[model samples]
Target chain A: MKAEAGCRACRGSCCGNPLVAELRGIPCNRRILLVGNPNVGKSVLFTRLTGVHAISSNYPGTTVGFSEGRLAFGNSCFHLIDVPGAYTLDPTNEAEDVARRIVDEGAEAVIVVLDSTALERNLYLALQVLERGLPVVVALNMVDEARHKGIAVDASALAEALGVPVVPTVAVTGQGINELVRALEERTRRAAPEAHSPAETTPPATLRSAEERWLVIGSVIQRVQRVTHRHHTWRDKLEDASVDRIWGGLIALAVILGSYSAIRLLGEGLIDHLLDPLANRLLLPLLEKLSAALGGEGLLHHILIGRLVDGAIDFEQSFGMLTTGLYVEFVMVLPYVTAFYTVLSFLEDFGYLPRLAVFFDALLHRLGLHGFAIIPTLLGLGCNVPGILATRVLESPRERFIAATLISVAVPCAGLQAMAVGVLGDLGGRYVLIPYAVLAVSWVILGRILHLVLPGYSPELIVEIPPYRLPSPSGLLLKLWFRIKGFLLEATPLVLGGVLLVNLLTMAGIVQAAARLTAPLFQGVLGLPPEAAGPLLLGILRKDVAVGMLVPLGLSPQQLVVAVVTLAMTFPCIATFIVLWRELGGRRLAASMGIMFFTAFAAGGLLHALFSLVGR
Target chain B: MGRQSSNFNPEQENLFRRTDSEEEALSNPAASEPPHPRQEAGGLRCPLRDVPNGRRVRVVSLPRGESGARLEALGIRPGKIVTKLSGMPFSGPVALELDGRQIAVGHGVSRAILVEEVPEP
Candidate 1:
């Protein structure tokens, strides 16, 4: 009942606190858990069974939290929970801890998804799950990949050895899914009559040490698995080269540059060819008519269409809920977000991110973080919210704090980056690189400082580099759509509200008052006009709009660079601020905010002084 | 236990033979008293970080505590054969090929892992 309560609470959200389950009541038999080692297609199998997309990817720790869904089989529906992948029941990390807790809380049955290619290693966890004495049907996933690798697994032999039904499956192709579900249905049915009787079922075996479990797994593998020598395919060779010291570095460089170019090309193409045209032709006339119908002069008109520039609406400069709000969110920011998630989804499903992490581990260590921190940092480049959320993968609180803080301070989301490029592109290529260079330098230096000052040690990277797989185009599109939909849902209201707030504040003359109050810091210290304070203040709500606001001010290139850098390093946009609070909690959030403000002003003042000395 | 016996390919006979010797050494330390000349050439246990790339070696001992348990869960316990793939520059994590899977262990953890090279014929 406690586990059921936990599942109920986490029905929509993917995460549930283990402590809440501990304080509750008895266990029920309606909940079946899908468990496996990391990156072994458990999530995919979950999707196959329940038709719920659990966001499967080709790397470890993708499901840092659990997701629950329902499986209806033969008129008997059961609650299916997709547990985070764990190598062992013995907790090693947060994800593993959650997995262990869910299993310990008891379930009706467990579906252990094992990788057929690496049966021996995978069997350790399977055997551990078997020892729990719960009914289990093993789904041997990725049989196709195993066959390609020259690994053969006799499903019947494995079933007999483990005394549980085993179904060979390829989750991506939907092969053998019906058989897997049928096997699960039969297994759970047979176990149901006495499932509630503790006396009828064998009690769970006492905890076995890692060595003892492996010994059992070894013998089990000897009976049912075989590996034959096979020539290395091109995929294998590419996988090897991607992790090689020299080639890995070169490939990493190319991948980074290539991804950047692709995102820019796709983003700008979307704007120029699709979104911009649709907006100007379709949406502009509607807005103009609305502007006229509202008399285009009162406070309400001002709030809706903003001020008319030369008797017409300038989408960028018109600070209205409808004029600038929709333009910034839909035309400017969404294109880049779409481009970013597309590329990132491909890289994730291709298993390239872990290699990138491995390649950068050494350098990241100096920053008081390990290589896995790179994943979160990469996610931060797309959006700071997911980047901060991905910090759950890191083991230690110290590493999470450091990574989250560094991301909030240094990493500019796609929206901010696109706006920065848009504003600075006209100045020159070199001017565009200024904020990037400053952020990069600060990333390293700030990490070094955090590493030295943080009392606890940052754990070293210990991660599996999954073999490369060709990502399915359908899967890539699904993930891209999922992320884009999430962005539109979360960002639309905030952008519109931000514009409305700006209009209301400006009308109330509060903007002028705040600008005057911060004039000393803006004018005397950062060498910017006080009017710049409004945009900088607006940066906290929506960064891209804040940066876009600067276009109308006509600031010199140097002043624009200073303001952009300060805005980036200062308070993260409110979405990121809330996520930071949730992830780091209140105390560390305060500390992180402190670090942010200090870094923003320090970097801003320093860059301002440097620019003045160079006579820019 | 019994070396898993899953590798039936003839090309891996040499690897099985090496595992036999390693098992013998583990079971009867005195019987292996007169160390093979190849073993002498390979030297005694050294940190895994110093092992040459592509050299097949047995993990002698892992760093104690949670890190050791973590490695063991991935099939890198003592006596398990693993090949050093490559180490990153500037003392980065070392990549090891274990049972057809690549695992990256941090430099510090790799240094604490004691290993001895398996002689090549």
Candidate 2:
């Protein structure tokens, strides 16, 4: 079923011209694709044209999936497909393959976006698209930056050189979009001229030698661009250190540690100052009131606000879907997720991700993975669902499987980590570090094991390091808003649904049956009680609530560490489970889960045994 | 794709290192009559992996198919000047700068590439 779905999705994409058009609300059946080299603001263009929030960043390989939106300009609106960025139609990577396939399927016309700063290199893609004989319009994006760098591109001269219409605009600011639309409209009008008039527009120099293309580009650049000497700037100095062998690694480390500390500080502060007061003082009473209004001892009341402590609301230990689930999703997970992605967005916008990829290139290479794995790993630190989605940036399936598996088992998402800190911090700070320590060592060992077992090697890193820019504040906030919105959308329903499911099962005696079945393993292997099984079971749903489940169990410090570690390492939450099932097929997902269980049990048992030995 | 192999053999160091007088002599054929010792080194072909850091080399050839095609699209081709930046410890991959762009070349692909040292200005 999984493989069939994968094939159908590919076919939909490969032959996806009309279908994709209709889905994005074209209605007229006319579609246009936005194509360009990676990281050149094609997504920003998509958002500008269609108003869809496609994530845009300064680094390459961000747009791995093709997004769609509708443009209602004039009486005629066409579906616009934001094709993933590729260098040429001759594809090397999976993302590039998708880009080439979209172009081959044909569109009414193509709007090829080019980075004005790198005109010649960016034009290489444009020339290939023009050779395909589609009506073309050129968008010279980032023109402001080009001018700032003492480089000027004569837009009219470039249009004359390429025999196409060129519109110079900043996609970020929606500048020149109207001019671009005008050029596009003209191309469409010229494409289907009269009833009997065939061959409306001729293909531009269909087959040219690479040498010939270079000659044309060279001449065109000479005519259009005027570069003047400039003094070295601060941006240039930072760009140098970002890729320097020694300093590069240090800067990456500093950025990572700083972000981690910030996430903890900020996440904890919000919960302590904002969320705790709101939940404890205001929201908890409202929920308890609802519980009482619905017959305080009834199942609905029990499910919503579980038995209150001493006739008052207890936020953490309530086990109520309304209380803990909502609190965990909004207050705990959201804050850390927001803090994490804020720093991540800054790094991505500042063009530091590619540099970090370069720094980890060697380390990942040794584990049969490439450097790009760092992106998914970093995202995993925030949430596992997006991390699994981000694995598409990697070029190979072998690397994707290993990366997804390692992330699910070892990387505790911020949702789970914040709860762990809250529950374990009460015992002592040292106990809080245990789960993370266990995660770090398990990642290396499990990675080595996966490397030894998995067949085939990951592709070598061959990525471009985009230059640094002072990230625009508006862009940063827009990107962050979409990300947090996405988190809330995915996190809320699944967490609430999971709580409901667990409550129903507990009422039906099913939870008792399952807990009895796993009792011996829970007691003998992990040194935890039979009732601890419920949180372990629901850990697959919402990890934060699962960690909170441990608080009411009154387990010692060592046992608390064992249970949290086991919960984190066993499997990702249901949202991530679905995403992994989609990304990797059923068979690979099963193998991954099998490995997770084996490792979780083995590590849990080992920790329990060692800690017991020390206690004696 | 067809690749044109250079006739020159690569020289590690020695007479090839100091070629200013020789280049100047070559400009005037009459003064370059001392039997051009470095003439044979002009066609100096070697794998990109062997190119020393800070030395510029022009791409001489590449194997055909995906690898060659990808390199070409990325602006790495015959006569393109590339300067070595940093190489991985185990002949893994070499970081190179060409056309003011930085890219990492893998172990196998870089080995398949044959280049000759470009003379400095």
Candidate 3:
């Protein structure tokens, strides 16, 4: 998948589904690609056109973020693909390659979404699209922002000049979206007739020289755009400060630490003020009543509501498919996942991520990864699957392996962290932080080792730092909704299934045999209990639930901390493992897992010795 | 993003480091000979990487192929005036302003690109 990610359409293995290369298939749908420069609201326009929920980020590259939506207009449905934004069709990057492929692969009509404010530069890409001789329409988007910047674009003049329909649109507000759709339908209909016409009538023009294209663009911009204001605004000041030497560093730090603290605070508060009271106080009593009503002892009661702690419900330790599973998933993990993605949504839309990536490029380079490599690692904090998939943004395989290995082995996703915090936070905040410290140190160490061993070149970063924007509240909420919804949709069943599997394993006595098999190693090297064996095995299925399993073992704070770090380091979850397999292929996946296991055991043993020596 | 061309392989750097003395002897047969440094970037033609930050330069030539063609299409061809912006201190991407937009190019492509420094007001 990693090899093919760059040229997926070129690989003719799956000819049955033409749309497979772009995104998911939409049955009986003609293709309509949303192509434009980065951060130009192409994804927002995609959502507005199709009402398909593809949350757009304001950052330059989001690794696995193309969407195919079913758009029905006037008894015709088309698959609207939101390809990654590119500056030009000449591919400078992987995303750009995907964009060029989608356009070159013969879409019915291509909608060139251009920023009205940056018309001159946007015209470079737009003119290239026009020269392709495909049915085309230009969506002169962000006109409202352009107007705020004292710029007004004449859509009619642009339409007449380009010889295609141009719809002036504010994609975020859905302004002129209907008109844009109407224009698209009419233009696409006009395309079929034009295709049959003489080649001389609308011949594919020779590729224009850069100077010639700029000359044409200059005249077009002069004709259509009217600049009313010459003075700089607060937005300009903010943009400058956000990238300034001292202030930019400070701002980047503030953005990272501030958002991190904000997420943690929000998640803890939700669990405390909302989810916990509902779970422990309200739901616990009711669930206990149900357990009692089911006679409270046999397989049904055990599977549904595991053994209670002192006749009271303990969500983490209960080990039930229903009781603890629901609480751990909804009450514990969901809050952190919700809060992290909420803040991430704001950062993405604020266009702060790329700037942050730029700011950290040099530092990341020392760690054997590109500056843009930070995106995948950071995204992995939200969830490892998408984070691993996001490695597609990196060009080469070695960088992906290094980033993926570090992420899987060190970075704990929100689910895992939430569980770690919930369990460890009870002991002390200091104790709760120990695993993260271990991971942070491990990130640099493992990265250096991987750099030494990995047999390929790491790609360098060449990314655009998108101009910053003040995120609209509605846009923030919409993005947050999509992320939270995705988490709920994906994690709920997996949590349930993981819990069911663990419980089934215990019932079959497989866990005992596994525990006895690993007991010598766990007890002697790690100074951990044999019961630690079960959670470590299940950690491969779901790290969050596995961490929850630690609560029942009644280990010391230091022991629990060691166990948490071990679990996080051992392996990515089954879903993430599959994605890693797809991305790194079979051989690389096996190598990484080998590294993961060796690291986990060695780290666990080292921590045990450290704890013993320090008497923690 | 840059014109990598698969020129640099990962194993070469480590292998070169391990056999550094042997390679030096092989390349320069006379161990006692006074080494004379070659004058590269001697005159008007220099790679973009060697250009100091804040220096405005005109694009002179780019490597031929898809990357070159694409770079040209984006208004970053010969005779276009561009200003080098902030370059990350290490061997990182060099930022340039061209066609009135800031673009970051990786060091590899910057090395491939030849530029002539120009004075700007």
C-alpha TM-scores of all predictions = 0.90, 0.86, 0.85
Model number with the top DockQ: 1
Per-residue lDDT of candidate 1, residues B1-121 (tens digit)? 2232221122342322332123322343322235445555666778788888888898766765567667877878776789898888877789989888989998767776778877774
Error of 2 at A318 (Å): 1.0
lDDT (Cα, tens digit) per residue for candidate 2, span B61-118:
6645456666777777666788876665543457677755577765556666667777
Clashing pairs in 3: none
* DockQ of the candidate models in sequence: 0.23, 0.15, 0.17
Model 3 misplacement above 4 A: A1-29, A63-65, A150-152, A191-229, B1-121
lDDT of each: 0.83, 0.76, 0.75
**DockQ score for candidate 1:** 0.23
Ranking by lDDT: 1, 2, 3
What clash pairs does model 2 have?
Answer: B8-B43, B8-B44, B9-B44
Worst 10 residues of 1 chain A by lDDT: A193-202
**TM-score of only chain B in every candidate structure:** 0.64, 0.64, 0.63
What's model 1's overall lDDT?
Answer: 0.83
lDDT (tens digit, per residue) of candidate 1 on A1-616:
1223333434444323322332223245767889999999988877777666778888899898787766656545567788898988888888999999888888878899999887888888887887777788899999999988899999998887777788999999889888987887788778453433232112365556666777777777787888999998898788778888899889999999999999999999999999999989999999999999998789998988988999998888877888888999899899999999999999999999999998788778778778989999999999999999999999888889999999999999999998898889889999889999999999988988887677656656789889898999988888888899889998898889888898889889999999999999889989999999999999999999899888889899999999999999998999999999999999999999999999999999999999999896
Best prediction by lDDT:
1
What lDDT score goes with residue A595 in model 1?
Answer: 94
